[model samples]
Target: MKGLRKITPYVPGEQPNYSDMIKLNTNENPYPPSPKVTEALKNFNPESLKRYSSVDNFELKKALSDKFKLSPEHFLIGNGSDEVLAFCFLAFFNSSDPLLFPEITYGFYKVWADLFHIPFKEIPLKKDFSIDLDDYRQNNGGIILANPNAPTGLFQPLEAIEKLLSENADVIVIVDEAYIDFAGKSAITLLENHPNLIIVRTLSKANSLAGLRVGYAIGNPQYIRIAESIKSSFNPYSVDLLAETLATAAIEDTDYYDKITEKICQTREWFIRELHAVGFDSLPSKTNFVLSTHPKLEISDLYQHLEEQDVFVRYFPTIERLQSYLRISIGTQKEMASVLTIIKDYLSQLR
Candidate 1:
């Protein structure tokens, strides 16, 4: 046991294998990826697996660069945004000063900080579950925030992000925009002015490519170079050929992806309204999921009821602030209607 690393790993949502079950726990997209992704997969040469994938990630990076209007050098691709974030923590958070993040934000941030032995300070979110921008005004080695933050699904406006970048211009500030597509504009729009800003994105949610595990970070060329150096030293081929090909195809099919994202957003709003009608109130959400609770009902009891009916949503019991809430992902129209019906049945039984 000597010199062994002991740390708690991030617990991902349960992936149930039931064909009849409605799964919305992990915030994955309900729809399948673009037809382009399917065609790319079918056309990808199986013989290419004999060799290592492109070490530079040029193919995928070029696709992303062309899509985002950035040079290829501005991207650092990874197996997932989680990998990209881990690299950022290791490469940029070396200073003795503490790294900063919202205490109640993405659970992975703490995992990475702990695993890397990077000092960190988790500022508590305000009573409304909104991040207090003023809390981040202090000195820190770096900062990472999940805009349209997880579990709560509340978005921080771009103006607030700009102010954070303006105040902390000297240190690295990473905006993890994994769910930004459903929300609205990206922090990428602010990139030209803020060299210290790093924007992390994933194809898991909006692109319906969670199965492929493709994620990348956008930043100034200098930051990208530093992260790339660390990535190459750790694992030269952080992205594989199949994933690169499929993800490239998925990115190029912007129309398909955009249409699905809008549908999810619209469904999210409708679901929130329906939940309100049933005496459940949900956070104003910008992401694909909503954190909701009923004033008079037990969240645990309701969560169990939904599960018993083959409907799955997320419930975080360990976090004090979220014990009373259930985070529900927006599914297809029929699936959402089923969930609503199941919830109503539960309410009727209580009466």
Candidate 2:
């Protein structure tokens, strides 16, 4: 318990055990991963299981580089984007200076800063829940932001990100694009010009590889070297053998990724329109989830009501501003229809 007190863990969305529940809390892809990933797993060699996997993840890096049209030297792979981000904090961020992000952005940013004992300052978002670029231009040792911010499901355009990069040439600018495939643009294009820029991505969202725990980053060779050094020092084989194989297959199958992303985006738009018609004000989302607040229902009460009806969605009760809102992951049409029916009945009961 004494050692445990020193560690504050990140709280992921709830994974409830209710069998009938339409689970939509974690923003996981409603569809299965590509058939290639399944084939890779089934065809895995038992002999390779005895040996340590690639310390450099050469094959996975090459696959990623080829997909992004970047050199293998410009990429680095990790167990998850969280590990890649942890490496960034240790390798690039200095304790003497502060890390900056939006106040109401991803909760993990704050957790990581605390875990590493790094100083940080959170710039508050504007009234509309959008990041103000001027706040980032002022000062900092490094900058990290979720492009399509978590919980809020809002995104800052690539042009705005370019402005931040142009303004802060001295500090490292890390863009956590875990949700970028759902969004319109990616900052990977700026890597050649901006040596200090790092783009972190994960297979969890668009690629449907959350269970595999594969994440990667694209940056200048220098920055990639820093992450590699830290990874080698920490855990050279952080990414397992099977994960590397599956992730490589997943990245190579861009057609599957594109198809799923398009479907998710389409479903998301239809869901938003339906929600609005039912009087729930949902933020325009670029990710697979929607953040919304009902005009009449208390979020807590609604959450409990949904749970009672075997429908699970994410609810953050701690953040006062967001307590009235619920973050709903886009599930299948049938699942969402069930949720809507439950909501319609609940609202009718309230009336």
Candidate 3:
């Protein structure tokens, strides 16, 4: 029980398992996977289930290579970005040096650190919840940043990423770009020259493939090999045959992917305007979620009111700095409109 005893597991967002519940919490793309994914599933050979999937996930990695203009040798696929990150923790960090990350980053980083017993320090975000670039320079083991960080959805510019990579040539710099598709730019542009940089990406957001659990890592050939080695040691098959085939089709359906993500972006802008009108303000967000707080009401009350109405959103009452804010994922325009209407009605009641 040595490793088991040192555990603090991650707490996932609440699921809207009911038929009538409005799920605007987990930040999943509020859209369906591409038509291609459906087709791939329909066309899959049931016989393939008898054999293990290609351990290297060659075809999917090759498709990603074409997308990023990198060699298949430069990519590593995983069941999900969470698993990809766990493999990274095992591959790069150690107990001797504490890892460095923002206090309000994707919570999984801390979980992996604890599971691996990799000591880590959380650097506090600025008062405005923006990262302090200078603070990361004092890091010990390595770096992990979620571009357009979770919950807050605030993006760190590539210039900031470049500063970290350029200065920290001696250690690994892991950039979780799970929301980068929504954010417009990616650190993958820096991977060619920065051997220390590792970029983790996923299909859960923009590609609408969350249930299929597809994610990849792009980095120097060396980093890719390390991740693959760890993966092979733990579980060689990255995903089932169905998931692999469907993810390929999903990635290939570029037009559908664009249309869906574009719709979410347009709806998010409109939703933010509505939130501001309701006396709530948000930092500019590039992810599928918006984190906002109204100066007049506590987040707990807002959460309870929403929950009472079967409108599910994410609120982190335990994180000290985030206690006042609620993270609301972008859903269909209709779903968001309902959220706005509910807020407006509730505010009027309070008056």
Query: How does each model score on TM-score?
Result: 0.99, 0.97, 0.97
lDDT (Cα, tens digit) per residue for candidate 3, span 1-351: 464374668999977688888899888888888888888888898997999889888889878878778899998899989999999999988647779999998988888898888899999999999997799878588989999788788988888889889998888989999998785589888987799999998888889888889888889988789889999999988687888889889878889988988899999999999999889989899989999999999779989999999999999988998889999999999999999999999999999
> Model 3: number of clashes?
0
**Each prediction's number of clashing residue pairs:** 0, 0, 0
Cα distance off (Å), candidate 1, residue 192: 0.9
Displacement of the residue 333 alpha carbon in candidate 3, Å: 0.4
RMSD vs true structure, all candidates: 0.8, 1.5, 1.3
- Give the runs in model 2 whose Cα sits over 4 Å from its true position: 1-5
lDDT of 2: 0.88
Candidate 2: tens digits of C-alpha lDDT, residues 1-351? 465557777899877777677989988888999999989989998898899998889999999888888899998899889889898888888747799998997789889899888999999988888888888877688999898888788988888999899999998999999998886588888887888899999999899988889998889998889889998898989999889999999999999889889988888998899889989999999999999998788889999989888888999888878889999999877788788889988989998
lDDT of 1 by residue, 1-351 (tens): 699877899999898879899998999899999999999989989998999998988888899999999999999999999899888888899989999999999999999999889999999999999998889989899999999888788889899999999999888999999999987569998999999999999999999989898999999999989999899889888788999999999989999998999899889999999999999989999999999999999999888988898888999999999999999999997899899989898899899
Worst 10 residues of 2 by lDDT: 1-10
Deviation in Å, model 3, residue 117 alpha carbon: 0.9
Give the per-residue Cα lDDT of candidate 3 at 340: 93
lDDT of 2 at 225: 96
Query: What is the TM-score of candidate 3?
Result: 0.97
Candidate 2 TM-score, true structure as reference: 0.97
Best by the lDDT measure: 1
